[model samples]
Target: MPQLEPFYFVHLLVWGFINLLIIIYLNTKYILPRILYIYLSRILISKL
Candidate 1:
């Protein structure tokens, strides 16, 4: 009943979307760079 209400549903969707964007941004900004750096270092070390 409450979940089916339009206002609540819209708010839930908006918050969920915002949270998703934040998570993606954090991963790309911080987590992905570190991972890529480590991966590339390993490859370069192997080549050398």
Candidate 2:
């Protein structure tokens, strides 16, 4: 069984959401693009 604390609940939840958004943003804008580029380049080089 766990005890629930009340104060700062909204703050914690909001921070979690913000962190999730940052991770999603970074993966979509940065990581995914780089991965796609690298994979495409490798395939192109192999073809050439």
Candidate 3:
């Protein structure tokens, strides 16, 4: 098999890191709050 280029590995690593950061940011910013709201609402409804 042929060897891969060094730049390809670097590019892939950079993109992977960027994608991971975006996912974490989105989860905390949007998904987490939505989930928390749903959970809190359920609790509130149960108490009523």
Scored by TM-score, the top model is 1
* CA RMSD (A), model 3: 2.5
* RMSD (CA, angstroms), candidate 2: 4.0
**lDDT string, candidate 2, 1-48, tens digits:** 234554468779989999999999999999999999999999999999
lDDT of each: 0.97, 0.90, 0.95
- Candidate 1: worst-modelled 10 consecutive residues by lDDT: 1-10
- The 10-residue segment with the lowest total lDDT in model 3: 1-10
lDDT of 3 by residue, 1-48 (tens): 236687788999999999999999999999999999999999999999
Number of the candidate with higher lDDT, 1 or 2: 1
TM values, all candidates? 0.90, 0.73, 0.84
Residue 11 lDDT (model 2): 75
Ranking by lDDT: 1, 3, 2
Over the full model, what C-alpha lDDT does candidate 2 score relative to the true structure? 0.90
Clashing pairs in 2: none
Candidate 3 residue 22 Cα shift, in angstroms, is 0.5
In model 1, residue pairs whose N, Cα or C atoms come closer than 3 Å (at least 3 residues apart or on different chains), thus clashing, are none
| Best-first order by TM-score | 1, 3, 2
